[model samples]
Target: MIYADKTDLIYSLASTRARIFLARPRRFGKSLLVSTLQSLFSDGLKYFSGLQIEKLWSDRQYDVVRLDFSGLKIFENLEQFERDFKSVLLEAFSPLGFNINKSRENIVFFDQFKSWLLTLPPDSLVLLIDECDTPLTSHLDDDEAFDVIRNHLVKFYTVLKSAERCLRFFFMTGITKFSNTSIFSALNNLTDISLDTKYSQLLGLTEQEISLHFEDYLASAEKVLRLDRNQLQNALRENYDGFCFDRKAQNHIYCPWSVLNFLNNPEEGFLNYWYASGGQPKVLLNYLKKHKLANPFAFDEPRQIRLSELTAAREYKDIGIEALLAQAGYLTIRSVCSNGYAELGYPNKEVELSRAQLYTEELLRGKNLDPMGVPMLSELIETGSLEEIVARFNAGINLIDYQTFPITTEAASRACIQLFLMGAALMPEVEKHTVLGRSDLEVRAGKRHWVFEFKYAAKTKDAAQLLEAGREQMRSRRYGVGPGAGELHRAVLVFCGETRRFERWLEIEDAAD
Candidate 1:
């Protein structure tokens, strides 16, 4: 099937400087963009026949060199990485009648390649590098190996800087932006267009594009799912849309891979195709584990980051979790402020649900509780069993490793509950404010609203009073007046030392005052 047309990107590239570096989340069409560039530079208009680029693009040819680092096998050590790096270079150049000696080091090979470019027609070389961060990202768990890979990449990319005069165009794409000093310090002339508003839609499928390209599929899906066109479109958007790269970009860019995969099997129903395509990046997981972030999936609200700070790579300690999550594709820009800050949040339901599951699994690991118990919790909530829900929560808390028990803050507890409920596809809102005050956690299953107030006391003797205080606050705040407001199942949970229990349960019917 025909995919979203990104030939307009070619026009933008042609008018810009030669060297460009783009960073995006995995499965967001980086490699496809690289291939398109290669085809544009080599086969010219023939490959782009009826596409937008065919009308705008000038007829020109360049000797293109495409290097895909993703194709290389996982390296056992630095030696293997370096050897394979050189081999890949040799293979990429060999097709062009340029023989790169396998024994030569990468630096030497670069020098040879640069000298060879001079013998060819002037302005003939167009270098397209894909998955440029594969080696470095693969070794993030090992600091020493990671540095070694970065050093190799530094040497390999330094060639592009020195040979810029012989190149007509150059582009490299990767999932994450390694610190400039760490990898691309030598290539200072390379323009980073990853966040540029003009190119934001260059890689992903915009809502308009989705409608234009998938009209037939949408019709078919609507008929099969027994929904109207608008409902079907909204369903698709909720599941796979809302990825925004540039702060000024108005169009919500849906993940190309997810969109295509759904079209390929519309009958299978909605699924987390993109998330399931690959394991969570070890680097991101390590960061989350290190920070011990309580609410990894959703922020209480959108987070703001300056445009300059958005892509500026810093040490993990200096980098905010929101920024890391945004770059990692688990979160996306929700809005941009006039002061040059962008508010970020989970891009869509697919990301929100997938991350909730992953985070819940991590929280439950080693605690001997079923991570899948999240569904049971939702079931209990749906049935309006406040006692069972509280019982299950207490039991789960008791099973947590003793050393990790006795969480210090109520916010953490609320985050855990939100994550659990979200994992089961239940809507959870933390610190949800009502007419009077904010509730600790509010979970919604269908039309039922479960309001929870947590009380932490240093002694068991204070638990009962604290729980009463919680219930009083919920009652005074009138926390059950929002949309889908039904029978309010309110519970007060008190924690003391290593023990947690529900002190009170109150069910207020919707018909009651």
Candidate 2:
């Protein structure tokens, strides 16, 4: 269903002479855009009813060469996958009267494609390739296999650069863009419009489009959600909005899948439809597990990166963690920072909670600890006493193998504690700075303000001394002295390295600056 009339931009794009490439997260309507283009080029204009492009584009039909690489089987080795893939490519041209196949020995695939294109008229073929990077990403785990497939990919993509004169309009879409990959090297003329301001709204749904398309649905959903029109829109923004892709950051987009699903089943009530549908994406999951989730706090804090980091072409092998998260839709531009930088954070509550759950699970499971205990902390806070909370928390930590997963420093230990707090929805801020000194963690509850100071002891007997030190650190530095100091409560957490859990949990009575 065409919710938004993006045909203007789509027409502007397809009417161009450049070979275009777009990178968007999986299920973000890339396939839909490809199908729309396929229709436009193949003279399927009847499907464009009431669309601006319906009257704009010429009715002349072209010989379209549309190749979908998403479903190719990742066979045992590069040799088998490439052989089958080559056969698929050649077979695609069979309908166009070119029956060339790999069975014709000694003729390479790209050469066969080049020879076939030479037989065609100039600017005669509209080539649209979808999921173009799947070949590279599918074999990322096997470095040797990845290199092999990447090498073959160079030959595969050369067909584009080779057939440039015979191509009418070219567009390819994928999830990730590789900088040092053979595609860019072989086909150097690709216009990467992924961050171009003009096409920023090309892939996702904008706010105005939602209202224009789903106003009636919104009116009915308002009653089901128990929210007024404004409240419902605000709620929707908090749950599914905040995706910004352009360098200028003029527009914020909503995940189309999440919004459509919410309208169909408003009773589900703004759940994390996109992330929850499949859990964490395969790329992110593999990255976190490969690193043993050493620095899970990376997901906890807002990250700042140069605009170049988001826009510049980088090899997949050398792409930054922040870039991966952004590319996979876990992170979105929060604000445009000075000095050509962008601050990135979880796009919405759904994404934030989903990340916390994923990272916490991987972090704890790596330590042989159970993840269920973390979320239980939120429930414990609502009902259980402080002592009771510690007891329950310790029960989970007892399963940790201290020898295998040692927490010898305050940082290592605090990171674990922060992960647990985040998983519990506490949203703990690490090293929250004040005029005097910094506190270990500052948590903002609605009415109550919390400052936590953590102290690590080498042995259990020294825990009490460190406990007092933590309290002194908080009091003298006035870690809890803020606008809500009246409702402020401080805690000193003393942990013993041997036990690998907080041995002392003290609640401070002092409210001082």
Which number leads on lDDT?
A: 2
lDDT (CA) per prediction = 0.73, 0.76
- TM-score leader: 1
Model 1 Cα lDDT, one tens digit per residue, 185-235: 788777888788888888888889888877888888877888898888888
lDDT of 2 by residue, 1-513 (tens): 445889989889877766998988776799899888988888757678888887787747788878888766368766788787877777777788776665875886678777888888888888899988877677667778778777777877777687789888889998777776678878889888887888888887888889999988898898888889889989889888888888787888888888898998998777778876753666677566454443564556679888778756787667888888888788877778668888888887777777777766765665533344353665555454568656756665565555556668777667666666666656667787789988887765556666678788999999998888887777788886867455677788887887778899898876755
C-alpha displacement of 314 in model 1, angstroms? 3.7
Where in model 2 is the C-alpha error above 4 Å?
A: 101-104, 289-294, 366-379, 395-415, 421-492, 496-499, 506-513
By summed lDDT, which 10 consecutive residues of candidate 1 come out lowest? 504-513
Which consecutive 10 residues in model 2 have the weakest lDDT in total?
366-375
Residue 64 of model 1 has an lDDT of 88
**Candidate 1: TM-score?**
0.86
